[model samples]
Target chain A: MDAGLIFYGSAIFLMVMGVFIAITGRHLIKILLGIDVFDTGLNLLIVSFGYINGGTAPIFSKYPNIFKNVVDPVPQALVLTAIVIGVAEMAMGLAIVMQIKEKFGTCNIAKLKELKW
Target chain B: MIRRLIALLVSLYLGYILYSFVYVHFPFGERPLRGVAAHYVENGIKEEGATNIVTSIVTLYRGFDTLGEVTVLFLAATGLGLILAGMKREEEEKPEPTLIMETVTKHLFPLVLLFGSYIFIHGHLTPGGGFPAGVVIATGYFMMFIAQRSFTPSEYLLSATESFAGTLYVIVGLLGLALAFSFLDNVMPLGIPNRVFSAGIIPVIYIIIGFKVGSEMTGILLHLKEA
Candidate 1:
């Protein structure tokens, strides 16, 4: 019955939807999109956890700019790093997909198992 | 399907397992997130002279990681460019499409470029930092696709920007080692806080990162275009 609980529920729901899409979708790009959705949900969860009561921005000007109430820069920083890493990973995946399309002429993963064993 | 069932069960188990951790009676779980990040942040200002803790953390504490990340982005762009360049257009050759809204974007391009540079320059003091600023720069180049539909970027220019940015990053890092103790170390007499050129290596490193990311992303976008 709290605001945080509601946000948590929404984050979980997004994760579930992402997983469902990844499992059910047949298209390669859609699968990638589903993974991105899941990543976004995870990022949301991290930032939400870092929330504090009426927190000020993490800026330190002389005189203890904020005696208290600063949410968490760590999580935000973590999310930034995670997003950049995800871009690299997704780019590599897309490159492989492009190469597969060039060779097999189709993007469906099911049809991509030309290499037996 | 068995896969779905497995996924559902795993998620349910994870939720149940982490339920106590996430929903404790207290405002937050056991501790409030300062378990490991305290040592550096406690005296970061005294050392780094940057008012923004995030900037200090990014540009000082974990600079090597930032270096590696920029390298990763550079490598991805390189691999993607090679792949796209090698791709043989299989579809039938057709007449080129006419440029759409060329005049407007042509005028807007300079403004976009200026904005990107501004963001990168003030990354240490503002909300927009290296990565986002770099993306903005790339977006400036992207505007060119709209300005001149038949036009393509001169590969040499983009590569030059990328190399120059990359070289700047390494040279800055080396300077840290040369003057200070280690690579990427923040030496050079930490200037007074909140100045444009303060945070000895922070601004320089971020500017290089900004440039590298901008050039690499622009290359990637151009590479992905339908040739």
Candidate 2:
């Protein structure tokens, strides 16, 4: 019934689903999508960590009780950085995937025997 | 079948661990604003003259991290370029965009660019900042790419903008080191809070970051498209 539990539960559920997709996905693009989902879930979890019961954003334009009511700005800032880095990482991953497809003429992970451990 | 089973087991284990850890340790919404967050919220207005506490923290209090973040983005873009460089270019005839798309893009490009600039320029006061603004600018460019087949963005120009913006950012940091207390320190006079041009170096830094990120992203998109 608690709001915190719902947020955490959904985040965890998404993360688990992402992991499953990443592990089971045969297509390279599917794996990439799975990773993206995982990244989103993690970002959501982090932003949720900064939530106060009824806190507003951490801005001071026209809000009263600035200190008492503002949510944690630190995690929000860190998440901003994280989101950018995630984009960069995704770009790099997709580039690698593109190269793999060009080289092997396939996007299926199961077909890439050389990559198998 | 075996792989799916393994994946299911692994995901189940991960979910169990995460759920248990979060349930036990973090009570989520009840988290009080304390520690560094409390300090920033308390003194952000006086110290940085920025109403947006997150902006102050990102641009001023923890600026070095931002510099590093930008460098990582640069590296990623460069790496993508390198990885895609060797592909042979095949000139395939592409269909022209629909009339509606062209019309909408022609009418919307300038507005999107203006809105992006506004978001970054008012980053210190508003919720949006350099990253989102830069993405918006890149989206505008992407629309241009999609709508106009002849619209080829000059690679040299994008690279030049990215490099110039990156260099300007470092120069601003060096200026801060020389004139102020530390690198990326607020050397400019902090004007009245909650106004445009009030956050001193914060807006300037955000603008530089906006340009840098925008060009870098455009370069990556171009590379991907060409490859």
Q: What lDDT score belongs to each candidate, Candidate 1 first? A: 0.73, 0.90
Instruction: Name the lDDT of candidate 1.
Output: 0.73
Highest TM-score: which candidate? 2
Q: Ten consecutive residues with minimal summed lDDT in candidate 2 chain B?
A: B22-31
Q: Write the per-residue lDDT of candidate 2 for residues B14-74, one digit (tens) a residue.
A: 9889889876877877777788999999999889989999999999999999999999999
Candidate 1, position A37, lDDT: 83
Residue B20 Cα positional deviation in candidate 2, in Å, after optimal superposition: 1.5
Q: Between which residue pairs do clashes occur in model 2?
A: none
Residue B107 local lDDT, model 1: 79
How well does candidate 1 reproduce the true complex, by DockQ? 0.43
**Local error of candidate 2 at B78, Å?**
0.7
> Candidate 1, after superposition: displacement of residue B154 in Å?
1.9
Model 2 stretches with alpha carbons more than 4 Å out = A63-67, A115-117
